[model samples]
Target: MTLDPKEPVLRVVPGPTDINANGHIFGGWVLSQMDIAAGIVASRRANGSVATVAIDTMEFLAPIHLRDVISVYAQVERVGRTSMGIRIEVVASRDRGREEVKVTSGLFTFVAIDADAKPRPVDAPE
Candidate 1:
């Protein structure tokens, strides 16, 4: 099941290179997708540059298979002075969208940055 009902931040399809020798998609590939989705949400919220600070938590619930369409969902869970906690979830749609399974969930921290790559307030004006 998808973690959220709203639209996904990113949808991606895995290629042959993404598959592992075990015939399942690589966990690192799924993690990259989650990070990308979280970065997108964090950047939009910060309204400027942002950098990933940390991954607070992560859980891999199901194995992703080849030909599964990955839907990454992310949102701002909390906003700090210079950082935001992004909640990210990944769902894999299989069998041509007939079945969907929650593949992974994670929480990431992102800090807003200025031109110098220093921390900046999240509410800073445009």
Candidate 2:
């Protein structure tokens, strides 16, 4: 899937509270951002609420430093009757935006749910 930096699903800077003892951002924090971004994309496609069912794969390529701007990009890679597999990529821009690094990436699965919270068809008419 093509990820456009010009159109990130979410973008924000890491805070001091989000840092680890190693002077890098916490993995959990990054994962949370990925999930939020993936949820937005999945919900838009589903035209309703979607829950994260699984993280099929994840990779931590580099550490994210404080003061770096984190940009998350996500796209629906595949969709089933009720579930969608979204591919998420995170990039960190540092050195006043001169340098960009791919820090984390993962494939997360989300299932659309109805008002009663039961799984619903993703293609159902809204």
Candidate 3:
């Protein structure tokens, strides 16, 4: 569930504070990062305010320890009139030591919103 460089998206690295007491990255922390990444893709495609609607089939494959430098990549996989589906992958590596391993991944659905906070049609990218 990792993303190749060909995908149009951005990468994010989490910091030490992102980890939890269990010494592994918290599931909530990971989901937040994915949401942020997905929001970037969603906003660009929607061209307006966007909110997370749903997350599907999220699976945590490996434990992400403190300072593991997790990377998140996201892309718009599908677009509807009012909503867009984004695919996000969370990967972690030990600074070129261990190869990048996918720690978790999921699909997030977002709905475009207007200034009034009402669902609106997502504009296709130019």
Runs in model 3 deviating more than 4 A are: 1-13, 95-97, 124-126
lDDT of 2: 0.93
Candidate 3: worst 10 consecutive residues by lDDT?
Answer: 1-10
Q: Global lDDT of each model?
A: 0.91, 0.93, 0.79
Per-prediction TM-score to the true structure, in the order listed: 0.94, 0.94, 0.83
- Residue 86, model 3: Cα distance from true site in angstroms: 0.2
Give the Cα error of residue 108 in candidate 1, in Å. 0.6
Model 3's TM-score against the true structure = 0.83
lDDT of 3 by residue, 1-126 (tens): 443535535455567777788777788878888888889878877876899989966888998877576668788888899998998888787766567788888999999998878898888332
| Model 3 pairs whose backbones collide | none
Number of the candidate with higher lDDT, 1 or 2 = 2
lDDT of 1: 0.91
- Which numbered prediction scores highest in TM-score against the true structure? 2
> Given candidate 2, what's the lDDT at residue 124?
94
lDDT, candidate 2, residue 20? 97
